[model samples]
Target: MEKWDVVVVGAGPGGSYAAKTAAELGLKTVFFERGRRPGDKNSSGCGLGQRWWRDFPEIMEALQGLPSVRKVEMVVINLVDENNRLRYRCGTTGSDLCANRWPHGMDGISIYRRDLDPFLADLAVKAGAELRTSTLVSDVIMENGQVKGVRTEKGEPVYAQVVIAADGAMSTMARKSGIRNRWGGGCTLVPQLDFSADPDKMDDVIGNAEWVWFGALYGAYQVNFRDGFHIGAGQWLREDWDEKPTDMVKKVLQFPAFQAMCRAIDAKPREYQAHLLPWLKKPPKTYTGGMMLVGDAAGFPCPLEAEGIWHALTSGKIAAETAAWAISRGDTSERALSEYERRWKASPLGKEHEFGPEFVDLWNSTIFDPKLMARQIQLLLEFSMLHPFSVVFDWGDAHMDCFNQHLEHLLDLAPQFADFGRTYLAPLARGIWPKNVKRILLSVKPRIPVLGKLPDNTFLRLVAKLSKSLAPYLDPAVNQEAPLPREVFERSRKG
Candidate 1:
């Protein structure tokens, strides 16, 4: 039995970050993983914002030396008709309309997790943390209703003053700690399949960018990478998921878009692996009590977007600071660790965490419906085509209120907007547009700038006005609890 100041289980982003930060702060940290090597068990590609690396300057510096696929601009999103006969595409970003734009890069960066994950693990070692591979954490050690350490597969006890569970999704530790049960049906399980292709052909197919597909490819979404492409889909499971991932990929390729994506890459799906992705609705109140839960263990995955890598890394950093605070005080009490939650609330990612559930409901429902998905793409096209500048830059960066306002604006166009989403939008578009135009337009620029760009103050006011109009249709009770931003009541108001 070797006692340590902090023991971090799972060497993925969260675990490695916790170990690195704590060790750098002079704590004796031990990081463990079950994988044979850092990248062995990791996936191939992921879509994430570059802002995630803002806190870890060293990580960003290293990214400069790695191969990257820059998505400086994006074209319109595509939505398919049921028969796959008609396709619609539209330009959603300003890079397509304007030649020059500041920060001339993708809104986010896409990387092969194999390369990126291992790189991050190495950073922990450089920061003074000892990382052990092939070590599995099977259970946690608890005494007097408090956690003390963890039990390993080798039957060894790795004791620590404090333990941080950065285990990825499907965390056995989280369940043992009673933080959460098996995730609910609302959680989306995504299986990713990676395929290799010729560099030139891959370049031509991917073309310096990436795109997300919804309600197509058998209603499964897809993303492409530089050396290859990723194909798979996710759905809310009402029961425990026991199906092999390879089978799921076969089922997903049945979708027309998935087929097209596979053909474009000039490859066949020979293999697949499954990773559990959890959608966390809120931060757990009691993630620490001599033990802390971060990353997917705490259900930090964004419920709405199905993206958790950034959240995992961010929480891991905060958990590290809080762990240090505990060690310096020579106490690992729940009260002391509360700073973890407090600091989290102050961070940008924390602010977004609060609305996870709301976002999840909206996205899952809207995205699952093919007709609604297509109309949404069409709506974006209509707006972006008309007001390229306003639609492009400002609309995206505006405050939450402005986005909510636009939602209301779209709702007003059709009285029963939410209710008649797919059932109406599909028929309406098919009936309204000439078949030829629809076919040609699907590949053209999509997205709209109807929300009108203005200075911050004026834009906020516009959002408030639209929110008021939505009051009649929305549930007053829920609105009151997490009040939608009104003109007079801004979520972030400065004096």
Candidate 2:
């Protein structure tokens, strides 16, 4: 029996990052991957958030060297009617739109997992962690009610002081360890297809932009890489739903806008992949005994955007730090490992999960309805396409009357809007005051010429100091329990 300081299941972003950190700390770490190599089985709409550069400079430096990665400068939201006619289109670029929303001053990078995962795993190996590919981890070995190690399908027991489960949403280790019994109603299935085109053609067509399409049969997104595009559609699934995610993918491809985009690029389909993406209503119990879960295993994907890479990397680093601390103290007990959960909850990763259920419910009830969304998009198009000068001077009264009529139509859907406000909007607004304040400050700072030229580090330090100063008041408001909007609405109706 070979003993190691840490054993990580799955060589995805989380597992690789954990291994890298543990190994760098002089801990003997081993990461296992069932795939022939890291990322062989992974699929995503493939946007790596800018937070990675802020948190792990070394990783960002390495990623910059990859030829396949492309910086995303803009994000376009498109809405098309059932007839596949474009109803609304909006695009935003520059610091005002992207940097204010992101913690870092850049949007994100688009990269395929086939390149990213292997690169991350190699980084871990370079940091002195051992990588074992084509190895399936069947179960965690338990002794005296503590996780002792992992047993491979080949019946070999690899012992470790601590085990990090990063085996993704359908985590075998988490289920077998009894940490998670079943997925929640918010679980989504995303079917994705990768297409390759001429690099110049892709750049010309997409212009370093990502596209998100609503008012379609399903929610679809597209990311443009250096020479290819990753496109996918996502839908929340009930346990009883029989239709495959591929069917939804096909439906999305049928949209005229999607078809036109594909035709414009003359994209040749390279691959098709689907994944089970988990969106937990709340954070799950992430640690027990000598075991800690990170990434999708612990349901760390962002509820609003379903962005997994940032959460995966952040949680992986946190788990590794906690494991290292526990090892140094010679206490791998459940109580000691519980610190991982506490520390994560204090971080941004935990805060993002706070409103997960509300976001899911709101989207399912409102934005997910294609007909309602299409109507709203149609009205938005009507408003946007009108010449501003004509509206103000030539047809002022008539245009105003038309706008008021559209408003009335939208108001008729007030029940749905009310449901959203109560369930999602109000709670999110209450919880994110600190974040909103930060965004406002960031937005305002760029207008001061001297202040705008300050280095990224200086700006970040100032932001951190401001956040720390406000934590005393803001933390309580964010964490305080509040009645659900639905409950309040029901009570009001009864009254």
Candidate 3:
């Protein structure tokens, strides 16, 4: 076919979701993948979060029958030291959020792009969108400063009413269609490795939880799958491009934590993959006369975690919604296509990018002060383990004295946490204040900064406060043990 209602480029989450939504909306939709099949050429840590499942019911319903995903029951943030010692471990069970929202009440999920991509693509296909594989869409076809379609590397032209670029960070579709000249310094480099191991052994060693490693490359991850785990790290691209991402990854590969996990699972190298990701603090220009950019093409990856699958899926659906609306109205001009940008900004995904670059980078600054983190973790552990009612194991404790001591400790630490929040996050929260009022607040900060800082801790202490407030209205959640044992999780500690 020479023309279609929409041409969706790239068959990852964004593309597939766009095509699926477009097809379901009675629009002729076709998506192209350069790989031999969907998911064949993609790789990542693949740890989907609570927002991914709880926010999108369609995703959970689709993955319900598939054996492709592993339920994430726990998430542990492993803090390592310069000497390669696992200094402390802090994270929580998904049970903290209650399982009413998650599939089977799991905390999160883990899967490989090899499994996830094809599964999502098949959904698009089943929904009546044509899937064209091994077809490289080299450039977008343009007419009178508007995107008309895409031209394949083989020189064939396919026309469409609207084009959606779901083609990832280094998007040729986005660049060729004039989304922006290039990502330039606004991208991140990530390296990943997949391993194959005995499924039963993997179940024994890793279970269903994912681990986040600090004091590694920027921020690193290790996620469990059915047979093995996926491990990866990310670093922002620099102007000079002095260091190789692989060399940085190699350092992580040699770390005690990485080795401990590998040996525990008898992990055999499955594959090494690297991809560029958009690391912008804000969304870029996403729409033009006849096209819109979704996913990494529009720079939607989280500034801190580099997580963008939800961004892809959500933006893809929104783009298709706009496409369907614009096409129905017979108006595909830039003004009509602008709806795509508007919808995406008002989405849950949009709120993620509100912070500036400095604030986003602050999350990765923990490697600078392991000792400070150690102190904080010690306080948290002491506080959490102080009384049964803290995590609410029981109401039988008459030991209000012990609880009072812990409360005093938290109060002391609260000021320090308040200081950190004021230094880092206050700028991002600036929008909450009017311009003239903001000046007044800043002027008062020098005079009454300490008194006003407690409100800042409200967000950080949300979990503790929420649980206490809801204890009467809600049933106490049953605590579950993490898949990986404490001893096993501590294997990385230097002797």
Q: Candidate 2: misplaced stretches above 4 Å? A: 95-104, 240-242, 367-423, 432-495
Lowest lDDT 10-residue stretch of candidate 3:
470-479
Best by TM-score: 2
2 or 3: which has the higher lDDT?
2
lDDT of 1 by residue, 228-255 (tens): 6676666555464565546555655555
- Provide the lDDT at 427 for model 2: 50
lDDT of 1 at 80: 49
Task: Compare the candidates by lDDT and give the number of the best one.
Answer: 2
Candidate 3's TM-score: 0.76
* Of 2 and 3, the candidate ranking higher by TM-score: 2
TM-score (C-alpha, index-matched) for candidate 2: 0.82
Give the TM-score of each candidate: 0.74, 0.82, 0.76
Q: Tens digits of per-residue lDDT for model 2 on 134-223?
A: 999999999988998999999999999999999998899998877877776667888898888788877777777888876646677888
Q: Write the per-residue lDDT of candidate 3 for residues 1-495, one digit (tens) a residue.
A: 599999999999999999999999999999999999888877744878777666676776576455556778888777665566765676675454576755457666788777789889999999999999999999888999999999999999999999999988888987787779877677877787778877777778777778777653445778788777767766667665566667755656767876887888788888788888787867778999899999988898887677789889989999999999999999898999998888887776766665546445565344223345445444435445543555354345555765666567778778776776777665444333233332443456445545555553342244234444222111223122212222222342221
